[model samples]
Target: MSDTTHAPRAILADDERLMREQLRSRIAEVWPELQIVAEAKNGLEAVELTREHKPDLVFLDIRMPGLTGVEAARQIAQLPEDDEWAVPEIVFITAYDQYAVEAFEQGACDYVLKPAERDRLLVTVERIKKRLAQRSGEAEPDGPSNGTLQQLLHSLSARVNPGGAPKYLQWIQASVGQTIQMIPVEDVLFFISDEKYTRVQTPTVEALIRKPIKELVDELDPALFWQIHRSTLVNVKSINGISRDFRGRQLVGVKGLDEKLEVSRSYTHLFKGM
Candidate 1:
């Protein structure tokens, strides 16, 4: 992530479309000068768009599909240093109150709740503006670097899965006609879902499951099945390549499959130059 420009730019990422819009609108009210360059609907997209835009700040929802906000923040913190821009400041936007203790540990990262009350948002905006102004005044602007933030992030990450990470679904149970078939998750190429059924594609066969995308996201390992769209999760190892159409939307090619999966605008940042 980079922040070479003096003018502030920010990005919002959340799975809830309405929540994102609401936050954007509220932020606009609180800080009219802060430009929202882009929006993402998931944590994966949040990380990708941050890298692509190099915004001055990133507002992330703690809970999202594929990757959590804390995980995304860790990735942003570790992004390679760029001469053109500095890494962006991270702020957590969450409704969960349990993370508050860890969040405020050593005054790590700023946060706003789900509804984002105007008064609270104003405070958050002021703090962010102050930090940005401090950076702009410096001779060499580097991203926000504080050891407390890293510790806070680690504590938050561990708090998310206090006991340990649950075993991700390794075998998917799908209905093939009248017979139920067990498909190994690793062998599957991709999974797409609609309102009623989720289509599971493998090299040898295709199957359908009653599970919706939202539910499946929790059971699947985010590292293995990368979310390409709200209703689609493609296996990382199955990615053959990427291509584009006339309209400029990106498409992902899967190995052992001829069809290319559509990459939603929220996820185009994953492909670099969408």
Candidate 2:
């Protein structure tokens, strides 16, 4: 659907060569004109291939040796932009448990179960084709937001745990100079990002950890650590009240904390009046 001058190109990335071959052969059958440009055996290779080829589509496998499929997609999504380039459509090739596959219901991206099914793939192909047409300037393009994709990737990563349920963190081990401290999650008042580090503040003391808020969002109980801003998450129990700044911005006041966090417009609904 992209520029009728030629077939849209694609890259296939999976650890197993046999699985890649099988998927390639199957896709050829379903979408004959679509060109298979390259194949990669790992997540790192996938990103490299995508960068070199700039293909219109990329099929990624979730689990790889060093980097994960989600991580690869994250990089691909952030690849340098150009007036002539459009980010490739991404499809995940997952050999996930049945429970884990349910995470795809949100339709964040197209996916195919292992040992791909022709009938099911037919539907996926049709939908993808329509989106490609939209991107080709046939109509307005519609896709999931970056935040939605972040949440989807988070849900997919949690499946790495047994039984497809995430085990939330109860304690945080942070290093302080020569001492390592065990900080209970209940004692933390808030977390804010500081470039590569995350500052963890408790009622009595503060500490730093390398874990970013994006990573912590899944590891912590969401009901307790509500995200009031992009770079900040506050413990629900530690929140004293919500107030508005003179500029009409929502400010979250934390118990025992002097500085109030400015709530981004995207998250003001979290403090909506009942």
Candidate 3:
């Protein structure tokens, strides 16, 4: 029996509308068994959608606004463990020359060039199918190790931009009822979005800012803050542990907070072992 009787789900991310459509079409043709669950226009949206869908694979455009494919892939690969779900296999899509594509293959990473020629994409599809088959009955899914992928990102980063790593927001200025206060990013426990403002909480104080969670995601470092819900981002350092409620939903306990943050079904992959 073929292990892939159930179609594998995937996400496609590209900044260009036509590129996204063309890639989707090519994938459908050569890998019709792949069910595309989500599509994203930018890297940040790609990361968000990936978290929500937890698809079997992702095809990321190397260069996109907010976060590049490399950056998004890093975050997706590093998501908190959920033994129930495996991290998606990542295949980069780029417009780089044939030499760069060859280098990617040499590194044991899969990639599809721009416009996604049929023959080239078929090879990638077959490779992924074989890997998925190998992973079917294993305790852990087969894919590139996180460390190896991280190293790959470092090597490819220079090709994308020979510049410095992205810098996240350092401080947040919010209102505490009547007073405006400056909260250091390091001191924050979490940020929860309301109708008009986002609540900024610390061990000692709670403040409100007009910025939404979407905007905060762009500013905060993904290494520091993790989005547990669409409207919530919690500090990794502040997470005490995870617990399950009556309905089997996951909740995050913070170091100094009375209220536990709920983890949505889409984001449950963030707390795997718990």
State how far residue 37 of model 3 sits from its true place (Å).
0.3
lDDT of 2 by residue, 1-274 (tens): 2352358889999865656777898898999988989999888999999999888888987666446677788788778757656667778876554523554576667888766778877877887787777777876877666567667776666555447555566666565554446578989999999787788899887788777889788778898999888899999998888888889998888888788988999998887772
Off by over 4 Å in 1: 1-5, 138-144, 167-274
Q: Model 3 Cα RMSD, Å?
A: 17.6
Higher lDDT: candidate 1 or 2? Answer: 1
TM-score of 3: 0.55
Runs in model 2 deviating more than 4 A are: 1-5, 97-103, 161-274
lDDT (10s digit) by residue, model 3, range 1-274: 1244468989999865556777888898998879999999878999899889878789998767688887788788777656556677778887655425743665446888766899999988987777677557633555566687777776676656657766466567567775555577999999999898789999999888777899789879999999999999999999999998999989999997788999988998877866
Error of 3 at 217 (Å): 23
* Predictions: Cα RMSD each: 15.3, 16.4, 17.6
* Steric clash pairs (candidate 1): 3-86
**Compared with the true structure, what per-residue lDDT tens digits does model 1 show for residues 1-274?**
2343556889998765656777898988988988899999778898899888888899988877678889888888777766666667788987666786557555567888766788999988877776776666644443345566777888888876666776366566566775556577999999999988899999998888767888878878998988889999999989989998899879999987779899999988887953
Candidate that beats the other on TM-score, 1 or 3, i.e. the better one = 1
Runs of candidate 3 exceeding 4 Å displacement: 1-5, 98-103, 106-108, 138-143, 165-274
Q: Lowest-scoring 10 consecutive residues by lDDT in candidate 3?
A: 99-108
**lDDT rank, highest first?**
1, 3, 2
